[model samples]
Target: MLEVQSSLDKFKKTTGYWDFMEIGIAAIMIPFFAYQAYRLPSILSKFGAILIAIWLTCVIYTALKLKKAKPHEGDSYIDYLRQCMEYLERHKILSRKLMLWYVFPCLIGVAMIVVGQLDLLDKSWEQIIDTRMVWITLLIFMAIVVFAHQTNKLVVKKEFTPRLKKVGELIRSMEEDQVES
Candidate 1:
């Protein structure tokens, strides 16, 4: 019984740790990308706008799907935590797909920065800064951040909330059982 209690405590701690980490990551990304947007609005182009729109569509779809999901059954607190962790793992995989979408723009942005710094291109400062290439890359990066935020929110809703709910239910059930006994 003591061992079971210890395991439950460990699971609770692990879940809390991951929850904090996710929140921290999301919080950092928001401010970082906001700075990026302000610093490089000129880089945003028509193609990038389309990409952002598509990314937003995916985010909304994923959120709706997760919001509609039903919680799984569990026999113990550890079981519930394990189930939630599995859900989070699935979300991690989905996040990789979103990351893939940003790869092209990221590479292009890096190349542009490097080439601009090295003076490999003969473009003027205004042309380099105001080019469609730069804005599109910025747009892609911003869109990725937005998509990540949405995915993180879904993970919190599907994993943390449900696990917390299960833990509460378990505590209530245990109290009732003890009272009856």
Candidate 2:
């Protein structure tokens, strides 16, 4: 019982910190992206800004919702554990979708930029393709996609999976105790 309470406290603290970080990052990035969109005054810039704004809005809404959440007023700590479990499950799904919204479009835009810059040196497309630069550009484009994917995997593996597992364990432990009663 003592150990369970200790673990619960630790988990709650960790969750609080995670929520803070999410909100903090969104607070910084939303305005930064908005400023970039405003400053550039281009179609691509505006589109990118809109994407970031959407991402930031989703991020802020989820983070703030999680942060402000409370267990039922008269419920026990077991209920709090259940509440946390539900919230974490929702957050995990949202995080994945949010990554798709942000990362995939951004990566595709990078690829498009590579294609767009082909004529920048005032050379014909055939002449440019004949050079080794096209191969190098392709390599860079692929690297961007691969690196972004690996980074997302590492974040989920390192930060999210562990916390989720802990929450699951706590929820089960509490449930088993409740069943025994």
Candidate 3:
């Protein structure tokens, strides 16, 4: 019980951490993306604009998702337990959906940035986007998708589910206590 509570307390900290992490990345990337849009020519400008828009939407979506887990104050023990369960369940649902909204843009941006840099070796941008680069980018994107899915599964199984189950048991016990009284 003590250990469960300890884990719960630690898990609670992550509720805020997600918001901070997301915001920090958004802060860093928004300006950079905007700058890319300003400086890049033609199609790359369009790509940069699309990337910025997607990234902004992702940031907003992620922020809202993380907000669902923020605990409110002044709840009684049973209510607090219930709130925790709701928070964890929200996290579980969001984790499953994260790939679609969060992973694709991130993977695309990362792959483009890395592969784009290869053009520094006197290769033309058009040449850089050749079949080999396409294959490599495709592979990287696939890897990121798998990694994100597995990570989400592992965190939910290891953290959110356990905390949710523990809080639920407490809620049930408290409800029974109230009923007995």
Best candidate, TM-score: 3
* Model 2 stretches astray by more than 4 angstroms: 1-4, 70-74, 95-98, 105-181
Candidate 2 Cα deviation (angstroms), residue 157: 5.5
The number of clashing residue pairs in model 3 is: 0
Local accuracy of candidate 1 as per-residue lDDT tens digits, 47-114 = 33334434444444554464334235568655554554455445446545645543454444454444
lDDT of 3 by residue, 28-113 (tens): 77777777766655554446455865787677776876686566644576666677677778778877788866777666665555
The lDDT per prediction is 0.52, 0.66, 0.71
Candidate 2: lDDT over CA atoms?
0.66
Off by over 4 Å in 1: 1-125
In angstroms, give how far residue 120 of model 2 lies from its true place: 7.8
lDDT of 2 by residue, 72-125 (tens): 424577666677666556656655665476566555544444444454345687
Give the count of colliding residue pairs in each prediction: 3, 0, 0
User: How many times do residue backbones clash in model 1?
Assistant: 3
- The RMSD (Cα, Å) of candidate 2 is 4.8
Clashing pairs in 1: 43-134, 43-135, 44-135
TM-score of 2: 0.59
